[model samples]
Target: MSLRLTLHRPPPGRISLAGIVPNRLAALAMADIERLPLAWGKETPALGEFFRVAGAPGPHLVFEGMDARFCDVARGMAAGECEIHGAAGDFVAADLLGGRVVVRGSVGAFAASGMRGGELHVQGDAGERLGAALPWQAAGMRGGRVIVDGSVGARCGDKMRRGEILVAGDAGDFCAARMVAGTLAVAGRVGAHAGYGMRRGTLLLLLPGAAPALVPTFVETAFAADVFLRLLRRHWLATLDAGGAFARRAGAAEWRARRWLGDLASDGRGEVIHIV
Candidate 1:
């Protein structure tokens, strides 16, 4: 069985479980695991104060009875798998170096901000600023993959530098704003002001609903990018195991994608494609 952390005593305030990882805790006994520090606002509490630790650490770590106030449960993990049974608070998997994170429920704002490498899959909606840059940082999401089965809020992929984000549901306004470079695929309608001031990146709108008008600065390109579409399917989407949102959106053999390049307001290398 995988390692499990059951919430026995929910914290009174937000708890920062930043450095807890299976690799480092594999050999720790219950008492030792309890001794691990958790930042509880102004106070530092032992992990055992909030969680009932059971089973030795392994490749998978499961969190049960999570709530909105449980902030930063798996921040900066470099490896292993984490499964959260309930909703997650803000900044989940912030600056993650590597690993796989799956949240079975909704997540708060700024999830997967500045993640370098890994796969983050969220089964429910993501709040504002999903995959966006941190407050003090200029660039966001250096590398990795993020899949949200439900809608995402405003400014998704804002100022992102690299990686891929797939949103199965709708995306809010200013999506991919100021993006340096990345790939964002949205299966549902995108809100207004999309792709504002993006430098270099690819945003795909595969949903059937109407989207906000493209920014005035982005001039439509007449290039037939059949070759690029094939490449995306063969190289990127094909690697997703064919069961996730990526496969559902781009897997059809007859799918056709149209391309538009712009944010000429910036480098002019960015693109927004509407896939039909």
Candidate 2:
């Protein structure tokens, strides 16, 4: 059975649940796990102080009744699966290397920052800087796939180096700002200044009728690369849920896009494709 940790009471302060991934928990005895120290604000406390731990140790870890005070859930995880039954705090799945993490509710800021590989699926919204670089880091989200079922806040994919982020709902302002390389597909509206200062990447905006206002640095291109669009459509079809917003939009027609290439202010290479 999967290891389960159910919060019995709210933490007094922010709790960092770093290094509590499935791979590490699977080897620890119940007693040892209960004794594991958690960084709770200015103090450290045994995990058992706030959570009731149960179930057999295994490759899957399940968290129940978590709230915004729980940070770094599954940070740096390289293997196995971690599931959160409720909302999570900042940096959820940050620096993930390999594995699958599913958050059933909203996540706070910087979710999936510095992630290298793996899949992070959020059934609800994500806060600011989703997949963006951390404060001390230069690049963000080197690899991995993040699927958000709801909207994301500002600066999503900022300074990203590589990876794929699929958003079913709207994205806030400055989405994909300073992006270096990657694919960011947003199904709903994106706020102003989208793709500002982008160097190299693909920003696929799936808004059907609305032509989002972009920075003047981006100039429309006439490249009707039908083959590439077809391939991209195929990829999204396989990656997203068959009945999700992204899949429905992507599968609606033969892939045709009004492409723009620029942020000439930066490297002038990134492309923003608006579906017609």
Q: Model 1 over residues 200-231: C-alpha lDDT tens digits?
A: 99998887545348899987778747787678
Query: Per-residue alpha-carbon lDDT of model 2 for 1-276, expressed as tens digits?
Result: 699999998998789999999989989999999999999766889999988999988999999999989999999999999999999999999999999999999999999999999999998999999999977888998999999989999999999999999998999999999999999999899998999999999899887886779999999987955688788788888877888655676677765679999899999999899988
Candidate 2, which segments miss by more than 4 Å at Cα?
none
TM-score of each: 0.94, 0.97
Please report how far candidate 2 places residue 100 from its true position, in Å. 0.4
Off by over 4 Å in 1: 209-212
Clash pairs for candidate 1: none
Residue 126 shift from truth in candidate 1, angstroms: 0.9
lDDT to native, each model: 0.85, 0.92
